[model samples]
Target: MNNRSQISHGDKSRNTRLGRLRDLVPVTSAIVGIDLADAKQMVVVCDHDSRVLARKTFRVRAWDLGAALDWAGQKAATAGFAGVTVACEPTGHRWRILGQLAAERDMAFVCVQPLISAWARRGEDLTTDKTDEKDAVIIARLTAQLRCYVPEVVDETWGRLRHLGARRERLVVELTAQVQQMRDLLECVWPAALTAANYPFRSTTWAATMTVILDRDGGDFTRTKRLGLDRLENLVRKEVIRWGAEKPGLRITRNLFAALDDRAGVIAHRRGALERVEFLLADWLETRRRRLEVEQRMVAVLDGLELTELVTSIPGLSAIGAATILAETGDPHRFSSARALVKHAGLAPRERSSGTFVGRTKVTGQGRPGLRLAAWRGIWGTLRVNPVHAARYTHLTTRGHNRLKPTQAQAAVAAALLRQLHAVIVTGRSWDPDVATFGSRRRPVEVAA
Candidate 1:
């Protein structure tokens, strides 16, 4: 059976080459893209070659999503796909629920950058004619062409804490607005009160005292024999007596008392609301602090390798910064070289060359924003503590670089810090600022010890 043996050898060779090509392209066996809409979603499934295998539009509700996933899974099975990956543009709260559901099913899910997708689609036509179905197809094609990392499923605790943080921010904003409104109202009736107190509506003690002052009647203020009048006078005297009889201060006090007596209902309502908000905020702050501590502890335990300790040796880098870099980059070995790490950190300048013209180089913000922000913050903090970094910053400012405008200098420092961090993590050694800067021309002047 020599002919049979030859056929078997040829088939194995062809399969090996096909596998290499697939690896180069980075496409999974099957991929689905979702175009999120208010009431529904448009979904498209594609094979490895970017050919649409199945397409459908479905409702964007919880139950509907379950049904859609089942359908997609069945279709994928029938098409002989190894595994299914889904991509969608996040629409805030609308897509979070669906995304979580998708993650729970162990299916790969990625949130495509909206701007990148738009730019990719722009090459298709001169006139923009976008629809849900077209967007779905485009998204599917994008996933096939450019393999993206799937987002990790966030823990329920983190989600709950994040929601709490958002709610707290909203409440704080509302409180500020209400306080401003109250101050404006008080100023309109009694400018003296506004001036003497310096906008005391924001102070809890002042608000409580004002609540009592405002509830009094004008008759009570004019009367000398009534208990309520005496109480009102005593409260005002206690709160504002520090101002003495200074005309500006006394005038403000008198006008405030008058306004309180006139608009008792509004003042009392706002004061009560402010006190309630303050109480809730105090409780929330305590809970948030406790939760944050727990999260930090958890992170420490999860990444207890020597890498974290090594990264902490850097002047400005902390555990959180180190962890962020590690999590974002996955593994240091993934970077074939140090320049790969630099490019991934967005610290490397982008090049554009065409014929005889080479365009001005600029830092391409193509990497993780969280990592970039952490690096910048670490560099700034290090400059404050590390003499070498501070000297570098000072030298940069003195050499015709505007001291007030030091963003580029900061970025340079961040790049240096990142490089040091990577070295420290990889080598399991503590970082020494002096040793690290020994060979660099940008090294600061050394002082005799």
Candidate 2:
């Protein structure tokens, strides 16, 4: 096993020691922790030593926010603090407005992980009682100990892309559910219809044939038979051509006849079933159209952003995929290093082990799920065509020891892709295959003699 996979007690101790030595926030700074909620927020102010100086609750509004911060600033000034550090748990979208306001006012806005705050609350108090006031104090104490990080506040372009990407994800999920529901309906009403193509919905030709059967003929395969193979083929061909799909093949027409001949005839309530299918088809089509529009908007937004062309220089990665990944990541230069970028995507490898028993290693999954998904999908296309990713994946899965499963290997490749994307964007350099897979089984570069 790789030494990194095994976490020993000494490692934990060393990490704790290092964390204690690091002074993330100045001791003279005042920490303002706000327990955020939808309508109102509970705020707490503490000095460097975690002494509660004041506490207040304010409604989440423009004037209210100003008053709350102004009150905290007054308290800090009275206590002779050097500066104010605003800290909060990422409570939904409530923190962004506060963080932005704090930024505008030149206050250091930092974030504490929810899990860390929760643990900190329980570790010392040993109580199950939880309240907003208590949580705000905990946040302030954590901030005092430098257990918070500066939150990333993306600018306008990235904000738009993130929203678009989220919308696209929802549309895709709805489209998938619609497709599955339609498939189930087909299975019940017309069993043989599914046999026409491997992925009927994905193929426009198959979709055209199904549309005619469902809409015009009222899900009546027998009417298609009465029309005979020649006329049936002509009708399907015309429909396919109208939809800009491929011409119907002889096998496709034959399959329709074969469906009619099958022992399992049309199920009862076939007309009602076809009507539902048509409704679902219409909805699915609309969702697909919306998704395409979102993708086009993403491309346009990407074109306006810097470093897009450099990121897209990787072989086989589409502009849409790059856009989604970039939107999720925001500004790559903000990340301290490529590994930090991978960790932000939740692709960081984690291990669980005891004194004698070794456990399976897996990803931390502690960061943005959307970013992880986009990175995985973004790198998927490059696995076959991109030499660097292909070689890295091969070496990871086929190595002598510590061989990873296909899924694990794919995730590793995705993390590497994220790291490479970050490196390229930060350095303002195009992707180089050799630089990506430095020690892998790449062919040696040749020079003319």
Q: What digit string (tens of lDDT, one per residue) describes model 1 on residues 231-347?
A: 555665564433222222344444445544454334434545434444443443344455456447535543555465677777766665565455555556545455567777898
Q: List where candidate 1 sits over 4 angstroms from the true fold.
A: 1-28, 62-64, 79-83, 90-111, 152-309, 316-345, 366-373, 391-405, 438-449
Candidate 2 lDDT tens digits, 22-122: 44356777889898887788888898677889888887763358678888989988889877888889877767878877877888787899999978978
**Top model number, lDDT:** 2
**By summed lDDT, which 10 consecutive residues of candidate 2 come out lowest?**
16-25
Clashing pairs in 2: none
**Candidates' TM-scores?**
0.54, 0.86
TM-score of 1: 0.54
The Cα local distance difference test for each model comes to 0.61, 0.80
The count of backbone overlaps in candidate 2 is 0
